[model samples]
Target: MASDSDRLRALKAFDNTKAGVKGLVDTGITTIPSIFHHPLPLHRLHADQEHHFTIPVIDLAAAMGATTTTTAPSERAELVATVKAAVETVGFFQVVNHGVPKAVMSEMLAALQGFHEETVEAKAPYYSRDSRRRVRYQSNFNLFRSPAATWHDTLFMETAPEPTPPEEIPPACRTIVPEYTRLVQQLGRTLLELLSEALGLHRGHLEEDAACLEGLAGHYYPSCPEPHLTLGTTAHSDPCFLTVVLQNAVGGLQVLVDGLQEDDKKKSDAVWVDVPVVAGALVVNVGDFLQLVSNGKFKSVEHRVVAKSVGPRVSVACFFRPQGAATSTRVLQPIVTNGEARYRSTTMAELVRRYRAKGLYGSSLLQHLSL
Candidate 1:
């Protein structure tokens, strides 16, 4: 295994090259930093920099009681209450018995891994960072601007609103995970509706407001031979409304929680373990926009990825964001009139545009929405 300094130097070299920004797409080198010469330091989320975050785990079975879809008003209310608590407190939760089959999830993961392990030439075409394309892969968002680079490769696929045809997906894993994407997209829509209800908005309110919906199936493959020196993904927040992540069994995913001392910078116990899979559950997390829209009732917490010494880690993160030329200017209805005002009105387009201009820096989107 290469030392942290060695990995950082190589990544630094990659950052200097145009091909590095293009990631493995251009050079066809799975080990990105090798194209360059300098290794880059991993973005470590220490205790001092961490925040308080505890994701909720909700049971879909509660919603589907003996009453069925025509359940009485009170029963429905109870369901809504549980969902509301999950959204408001943790801004994330897992849904078990969500109706999507376990076989589908397993197949999806297998297909994703197979795709990542294919010959570099086979995956080169999808390597650009241009957000307009439904699918693309790149090393890191800060490719062009950041001081250093992260150690990971990604395969992004957008399938929503209009499902990306099965033919468009790579042939390597297509046969095995043929219907997996479609099933997850359906689940994404259902979850979005639930989020709408949780926000006290009319059912489908968020969906309609978001206009066209898009998703990115992010396949994060860890760096081999030198895991401890780098990261699969750096500490950052998603730019979309919500994200559904499917983590592989390797388990290096950790959420930074409260435990920091006022004067100390590193908090040993600040990081907490996130329960991976609970039989059948889709890990749902609120994004920056949702936090703003909900007036802080919901949160968009910061999380980071760490590299491991064991076998490679695989995670599929599906981001749900607005699309098309829909006016981004959606006025935020006040959530709290009393006590210091929390947020200001903003548009979906504006937020995304700003995020794009900034190029995924560590800055919080919430800062831009201050009253």
Candidate 2:
């Protein structure tokens, strides 16, 4: 437990230093993981940890028609089966043949690295903890109600139809990422269709419900001089309907799976792999909202980012959320009813509000609401 005096001292120290003040200005906190009783050590994913994450490769080209025409029933059925299996078993998978080009991915990664490596002064203006803004740069989760701080610096940007203009994007990254976002938005729609089918619903069912979508680019810059003492991102699950993440060659992202010891966990061994850009291969996964809507039939799995000793790692995560203004408040029909009390209906706005209020805290917003 950290005493009030200890917290004050840390705050003073941070307030005194230029870097610390910069961090505070960007993150809106004097000292992160605030001094508290029983403040836990920062969570880190080590290779030795008894956790293994499964990596599934989903072929998106197979799910959608090569042309714009409707996919054949047999093809759709096969695609559904693959998605259902992947979601049920691993909860996280890699989608290849996803239509986003390799060139686009390469360019995006380069741009992100350029942005992070730029002078601290160049990146400082965007450094506010204001989530209301579509773009910002900061360290750790702004709503980090947790006791320990995550060890990473991040630049977050929201991209969708109603996107933050290119001018707002960091000068280094603006040009490369806009086109990437456009392609991803298209891919997101296609993946939603596959997820709907996997859930035993008609195509476009989920998309119709998710009338609009949002995308975020999480640029993870590792600790330079000392990387071992810190982490890139902490263990958590995506809060939206789906998250499409692109990882750089330097791989430290790991998904936690069932473990051996009473408290042991498993981690996947594969390095960074391409998330397919093909139609219907959006690497969809269950988010907290979807878990509630599906009554837990679909799972939102926990994932974490680990720091690398060699090079900085970057990943772009695009979240697809339901349109707050236009969509219905009720859960989709297929996820509920069926003569079973699997789940109760909840409004998207309420869920989003709760999630915003309680970033990555205990259990989940859905779990708390159910209680």
Candidate 3:
């Protein structure tokens, strides 16, 4: 085991490289560095149980009124019901025909992949730890704080509340980023509307009233030489209101779900289920704050990406949260619930502060915030 000081030095050295995991791969090292090694409990399921579950998939054409002049009341209601069931039970689902052009999605994914694959010199200029920078690239946002590092590098861009200026975007993906985010913002609004109705509130409640902002992260997980020793992403739940993700076919994403059988009474009977790659589908998952504001009616389940030996895996995730959450003084509580509030009322800033303190992969934030 490395001493504390030795590990810190290793972490700082890795960070200084600014080349990210891909840079390490470029050296053709057959073993991952000690910094990227994670502890066990990778949450492997029994072979028989691995393929037994899959997350729900929803078609949003009717809800978005894409095919007809107007969505029928029944069709809209059905859409909301599906969203409600998915959020409440699994907290994750995939959407097909969500109105973003498939071409645009492909372009964005390719552009991001291109950016990550660029020469280290090309990407180095954007490598930064400063949170204020709208566009930044780094290996792990919580590298020093986490118990172990993951095997991915991310190019994170804050695109909403204030859209990232096109000129500031990296040349590889600049043109497509704006277009992709615009369409995603529209899709996000529609989903929030459905979520609002699912909560038995006005259709415009989440989007128009609560007001959510957007943050995009383009994650590049290099092929891990020692896949079993590390994770592509640690098991963690998004802290925002919701997360929308687009992943390429090279899949490794998984969601941890309750696997308890009626005869089984153990509370720890949970399994890691693979989130299969669905062509032209975007994955959506509820986040911690959404679960809190819904008074525990909606679930915010933990999910993670497994490190794989196959090849580079690419995905883009867009996180939505209350606007000005980092510094806002506004307090948020459950909108309307039949029972007592499951979580204490708190401001986004405070919630975020606590989340950062715990780092990703910490115990459930909702449990700590419970009333």
Number of the top-ranking candidate, with TM-score as the measure: 3
The parts of candidate 3 lying over 4 Å away from their true place are 42-51, 66-69, 209-211, 262-268, 325-327
Could you give candidate 2's per-residue lDDT for residues 30-139 as a string of tens digits? 33344222223445335444333346777777654354356566776787788778776557777878888888888887888777666667876887767777788776
Task: List model 1 lDDT by residue over 82-152, tens digit each.
Answer: 77787665556777766568887777787777767666567767666687676666667555555445556
Total clashing pairs for each candidate: 12, 16, 0
* Model 2 TM-score, 2 decimals: 0.79
- Model 2, which residues run further than 4 Å from truth? 8-44, 47-53, 64-72, 224-230, 259-284, 323-334, 337-339
The 0-to-1 C-alpha lDDT of every candidate, in the order given, reads 0.62, 0.62, 0.85
| Candidate 1 global CA lDDT score | 0.62
Candidate 3 structure, TM-score to reference: 0.94
lDDT of 3 at 37: 78
Ranking by TM-score: 3, 2, 1
Q: Which regions of candidate 1 deviate over 4 angstroms?
A: 1-54, 64-75, 173-178, 210-212, 223-226, 259-275, 327-341
- Given candidate 2, what's the lDDT at residue 36? 20
Native-vs-model 2 lDDT? Answer: 0.62
Model 3, 126-245: lDDT tens digits are 999898899999999999999889999999998767888888799998999889888888888889989999999988888753345567899999888888888888888988888999
